[model samples]
Target: MNKSTTIWGHLSAAPHRSLFLAGSFQALLTILWWSIELAGRAGLVAPPLLSGITPTWVHGFLMVYTFFPFFILGFLFTTFPNWMNGEKIRPNRYMAVCLLMVCGVILFYAGLFAGKLLISAGLLLMLTGWANAIAALFHVLLTAPAGDKRHAWVAGTAFVAGWLGLCAYALWVLTDNTDMLNFSRQAGIWFFMLPILLTVSHRMIPFFSSRVLENYVVIRPFGLLWLMVGCAVAHGILHLLDLQGYAWWADLLLAGCALYLSYVWQFFRSFHVRLLAVLHISFAWLGIAMLSFGLQGMLFWLNGGEHYWLGLAPLHMLVVGYFASMVLGMASRVTLGHGGFPLKLDHLTWLLFIAFQVVIVLRVIPDILPFAASMAPKFYLAAGGVWLSCFLLWVIKYAPIYWRARVDGKAG
Candidate 1:
């Protein structure tokens, strides 16, 4: 494949191709909306683009639901079938879903520029695409010849819950209900995003550890998974009711659980391999997030819940530290492996991964540094630039690989 290679030709050939397209689209959105947000926050832009929801909410919605789900679905669509010993997805089906999602993204942005009708339509299309993708995976689970279906089912359930949350958010847009928005956001976080991440990480990290480290213990017990899910459900419920003052309990429990799981999963031992270290360290951020949430809850409870929780700082920790890092590492591995390249993390990629951590830390400065209030805008913009740079680097490195057939001359 050369410059003449059509995106349609590539997209219709494999699930990863479509997924890479979707991810690249979302990355572009991230750069665009983030710049708009930073400019507005820094008072570099006037007549703020506040419509049905705030700009911050818009950014969150795009990142959490739009940007990440494409990557998640891409990974799951490819791997879940293999896990269940089912057939690979047909190209036509996945291509249609990808097209629908792309259109939805376009319409959603257009709605942001125009009116609510377009926004509602866009969200509906997005939700439809999401539902279709999840349903396809569920079908694989249903039809698989034979395999351990437990983890796949759990992950699928979380995706369904996430769809429900997205539905609620769309409802908020249609009806202008702030409460619905809040509920959707909370549900999406605890029920949808975190559960999927935790469940997948639980299943994969230990398995990866066992493979990478000789005699490594695979520590995923059903009980532990259940406990983690239970804690997440409780956290979501507390958030839904706006009773985050009591969230410290759930947060602390989850933190403890995360710590124990990390220990049993041999996080420290995985450091010998940089790629595995990336996964292990990314999971470590789950612990950090829970601990931060617990602390924030305690502070808020002591101060009577008067907006003293550092403004979604803990959530950002999980988003950037865990989700983004894992995505980066996993994407790197998948791209290289599938593209007929060695699954090795070269020095430059490792340095970029470290830079990603720096980006995450920079993003948190405004939340943690009260004295740095005057410099918060600079920090925010700088973080966005850094974040954009990371994705841009990924795109530059992998876009060609994604566009071409596998170097081994394989079909898919």
Candidate 2:
């Protein structure tokens, strides 16, 4: 068997290739499915169909658990070894993870048509994949150097939390338990995705900026890090305990910290380079999202649950603005750097990234325009449509690099 030229060989050659490729496709597919469902529900198409789980729950599950993990795991697998001077993750280990997860997601889509049993089985498989990733990361943590393993430790714990959230989701699929569903959704956002993304941003964004922007001082304060983490976890715990109203303090503090870092990280200077600009722009949304969350919560509390302005606005901002934008920026950088291309984006991709900002606006418009209740679904369709299109184009631009050898003749 010629291992060098085979598709399998190329895919499994590096940890990021197959996983990132799969993630890009998953990102496209999930949104496409959502857009279809939205159109159908809005009566722009045929009647909508429901699988074993309700569409709302299904959307939450896929967005939180399925879509982002592939990219997250791919990035970590490539960086963890370097981060800790630990051993590179074995191809077999990450391969097992990728295969299991890809198959599990396919099964989930299929399960939508088949039955609840198939859906349950799919969830179990995904949980197993999550377990595999967690174990691999845990190994890195165990062997990492003693100096400042805090990011590693925090990111590792977030992965573990995500796995637990997947467990909760699996239980929800199996038993139709709302509590499990709620736990999975809330924990996936706060305990799982937030910590990891924040740590990566805190660790990398400044580092990335300093490398490109002259006179950029990289100030990574551990005190600020812990404070952000504290506020995030506190807010998460408060929401989980159904004391969401009291979370205003934590959310406001988080917003302030995020904005402070954005400024100190030289958000203004980033526009000098498109690649760095994208990362800065994405991080900018975190402050906006948190500010929205805190202000909305404060209003709700102050008005005695009577004035929740901008319902769902903050979440859409986080997911589309912060999460997806970072994914695009980070993944673009990874694909270019790892694939032996120049570290800059072209005009077309830059425009696509701008389009993503439009997507955030479209999504949040509906939330803020709750007065236009009749038009909300139309706005949902528009947001979903734009999101699907952007990712589709993005996948087209980047996915091929994963399967082909490096352009510069360097091995991955």
Candidate 3:
């Protein structure tokens, strides 16, 4: 027993291991849910078995809440201590939370198919687990001995906002109110996901750029970070109120600032290194998402709120283009670096990175198809397939590294 435990101690004794376990598990689930969505949209099956929820709602919930959080927590739990120069986190703390999340997602699925009671139970468990993870990170932030800690605080605050969003979603689920659910979803995007990602991007991208580029200097002022947060919050409120007409102004200003900051931070110069290039290009997607948001809002206002472009394209641009690409880029860097592999990008990994953009473009096709109404289903199916394929490839490439002991003979 001792021998077996010792052999696998690396996996069980590390916070990043716990997070990677959760992340890889949910990556599979992410594809599974999306595949089901593809089938439903293609009219090849009956409606989803989950009562009181539409298929699109399920997709959004799992995509935004389920798998993505695992990525964020994985990144933060591993990186936060480094950011603050704090002590390493105990593995058991994160392991328990990871288990709760995994079980909650499983129960949510089981309830969707078998018993509705499990659905509520599953959501509750998931929220509890998420809250615990946030608390753990916040504890680290509060106790850190000596670092800037400002970025960590910003991330911690966004996490709290996410917690509140989850609470609201749970309330809406219990009440069965469509409006509240919609509000919660929008909040999940603008409040939780976007803010957290942008905060991390603001902190890490410039730092990474300066590290790799010889002449690069850190030029993104902290004030711009606050501005982005303020804009993100306002964007969420406007979305919640369905006041999208005015939201474009907020988005445009935010987009302009983000682009300007990227230039000042020398993001363009970071493209010289392949690994840094991945981070730089993925970060650019944020500006693109902001641009999409502004364009969508302007089009809606011009069309007298008739939604000429419908809001789907811009949302997908953010979710798939910005969020997923960043996750892939960061995950690759962290996973390889921690596993004691070289950070250099190989052909296969580069292909995987490019495929992510293809997935984003494919997903947006349905919204932009010119008078090809009958082809929308095919486009949707293709997009989901491409997405699933990306993860499938990712799992094959990285799962072994995650499960085995680290290459360096060092404790995590």
Q: Which candidate tops lDDT?
A: 2
Residue-level lDDT tens digits of model 3 in 1-412: 5766764675665676667767866877776776776787667876466666666777788888887888898889888998998766677778878888888888888877776678888888988998889889988888889769988888888877777877776777688777778777877888889888888988888888877789777776888888888898898898778786889888888888788877787766776877888887887878888988888889888889875574377788888888888888888888888888887877888888888788778777767666655677777777777777877888788877766777886556
Candidate 1 structure quality by residue, lDDT tens digits, 193-287: 88888888888888777777898767788887888888888998987776778989888888999988888888778878887888888889889
- Which pairs clash (backbone N, Cα, C closer than 3 Å) in model 1? none
Per-prediction TM-score: 0.94, 0.97, 0.94
Candidate 3: give the clashing pairs.
none
lDDT (Cα atoms) of all candidates against the true structure? 0.82, 0.88, 0.80
Clashing pairs in 2: none
All candidates: CA RMSD in angstroms? 2.0, 1.4, 1.9
Better of 1 and 3 by lDDT: 1
- Report residue 16 deviation for candidate 3 (angstroms): 1.9
Instruction: Return whichever of 1 and 2 wins on lDDT.
Output: 2
Model 2 regions more than 4 Å off? 1-5
Error of 2 at 282 (Å): 0.5
